[model samples]
Target: MNYLVKINAVKTTNELEDAWSNEDYKALLARFEYPDAAQLKPAELKEYLFLAISDFEPHEAAAILLDYKCSDQLVDGQIDNLSHEMLRTKTFENYSEIDLHHDLFNINQLLYSAYNGKFPLGTVNLVEMEIKGDDNVEELTKETALKALSYGLSENNLINRLLSDQIEGHKAFPEAEGIVWELQHKGDDVYTLTISEKWLTKTEITNPEYECTVVPFEEHQEAN
Candidate 1:
């Protein structure tokens, strides 16, 4: 039986709750001919429940959990995090290899300049580019290459492809003015890129008033 179809067919929360209570859900799962169904643990069953309700493909959901090395005791928060990652995966599903390579070229160029030519080109893989501003650092998988590509273009991310191209020779010197970029080697093909503002020049601004009026309560009441 189609796993998603079967699970989704349970139309009501009450039905699902009752099925679980009566072990009817086990019978439903048994019909799917899942490998080693009898040996499945509570955590695995909970993951299956999460997958059934999620928007991702069953195989994709399973793969994501496996890649993250989720423990036997899956929780709601973990499922939520997985869902977010899956959304990023979907967003970049159509990202082409050519575009990816182009971005990679810029990234490698920046890295080479940052390391003073010591870092070899074409060594950084898609998985090595870390996403910025995440609460927890996630080790991206090959399937999440598109997510990396998207994050790489942002100013907050490690790659900062656009910023790298704008700087002369793609080199970020310590004494550079304006925004300063820094690269740190985090070992075993991992690198962290960060940026900070320095000697920022402020621009004076004036707000021009548009055609507008703030009416008093008495005038507003009279108009109404």
Candidate 2:
């Protein structure tokens, strides 16, 4: 399931538009290599902002901000600013990591770039797992397909050992309907890659902002 994070508490008309109106984000589409990566249409700019800002549970995000430990920056257990907002987001259920990867891939497709260690795990999943999962993959670039295949990730997963954290390198996951190649990366790439395994099984919501029970993927579909 994917997270449906919503801003909580009282709502104001103005609210926060920083993410909604940010223009600088458009420049970031370059990594994906767009025809006009240097310039973005207004609609495109605002759309990407929502994704960047919308990610993360409010409390989980807040904890990383200044004065979170002391609660100085928070007002009444909440921060209004999106960056460090204490009670900014309340997560609903049924958001798929697969969907998140797909959505983010759609966004990234607008840009021009190559995937590497620096790419977000979401982006990596886009180039790696999601594309392969497609029933009809008409065409995939050699470089792109090679990079993804080398990672040992299968569209499906196997569980030879339950709850075993041992590093098995690349092995087939039984749950995977067919061949499975495990994904492993070093350095900053780990942030997104490791999350695939470590993330709360979509069952564990240790983070206060995320809820255990959730919604389905279709209900919260955003405009494409």
Candidate 3:
């Protein structure tokens, strides 16, 4: 089945930088709604920016960040400061397997907390799916397919590997047990993903599994 994965969140520094490019210092200060934004030095400005956007949804914060324009030096410095601050507040170091799992769950929660629970934007159907197995091919509901794709993509290893790869065509990911993923480059900053999973059998339990396609959020929106 074909699924459309809408990436509603900005995950990289470069992407954020590319989204907005106005470097007017005064404008940057005004955008964040700082009362004394003009009086703040670079360090103070960075701190205020963090504080100002602390309560914002990730997408909203991201949109504001895209609108930001400042000198390259200042942008780099502020982004570095903000990134450190964000990680410090938003993530914690995991000391054990349980802690790691907890942290992963938190990350998932944070992703969902964006834009009224439609965020980190997992997979959704562009068309109906057909679950295919050795001797059976059955129509899968859109809802079930979405859940499966979302769960599959939620695996950290799978997502990390998928985003990191810049090459086109079939790729190998030995660490992502029970999951099979393929990439087809569509254009600049856009690609199609085909992912399949059979990890349920790891517990010696058999279940139906299916393949789905994913594309950029913008493309998916345009198609609709």
Candidate 4:
């Protein structure tokens, strides 16, 4: 669990300064909209920016931090489905976990939240060990274990399947568990692979088709 906190602090300070220079912060509040940078506590502002920084150009990330709204609704810590202000209200101070899988920020947001005790931006974790008859020591191992429930899919089984024939030669990612067939039909050969990061599993999203979005573990963080 490598933690990165300094960068977030710097970004937050920058946003606060921007809001101070412009009346945008006051105007946003007067409209009953999300608070602007200056209105945000530096810690909260940093978490928000961190959550929204994935797949964004450096300048774009900066712009978003300066202009977006920050509110509790926008505080899921994921950048997707949020206006600038909505994103600003996210602070790791309140949330126990941060999800950063898809709503935005990808892995970077997760990394940021991990340091601050917020959940990852877009992931959920299951207690594989506490399923049934498991010992405490074994349960500890199971914490890192992955299971498909129905097919008795374990992390090893999942990875082996991908290695054998499932993913078509795409290498298994390091922090990722294994692809789980979330939905499967009798006739259709398609299944949704439940991808996950180190400590959290992403919530299943309906893709409406057979396509799988496999982002390389390295590229899964922030796009260069």
- Give the lDDT of residue 71 in candidate 3: 29
Task: Give candidate 2 misplaced runs (Cα > 4 Å).
Answer: 1-12, 16-39, 60-85, 88-224
Would you list the C-alpha lDDT of every candidate in the order shown?
Answer: 0.29, 0.27, 0.34, 0.30
Q: Can you give the TM-score per candidate against the true fold?
A: 0.17, 0.18, 0.23, 0.23
Candidate 1 clash pair list? none
* Tens-digit lDDT string for candidate 2 (46-92): 45433443353433323332122224423543323322321222111
TM-score of candidate 2 relative to the true fold: 0.18
Candidate 3 structure, TM-score to reference: 0.23
Query: Distance from true position, residue 100, model 2, in Å?
Result: 33
Candidate 1 local lDDT, 123-173, one digit each (tens):
222112323323235453221222222221334433234333222223322
- Cα deviation in Å at residue 105, candidate 3? 20
Candidate 1 error regions (>4 Å): 1-33, 36-68, 72-75, 84-224
Question: lDDT of candidate 4?
Answer: 0.30
Worst 10-residue lDDT window for candidate 2 reads 7-16
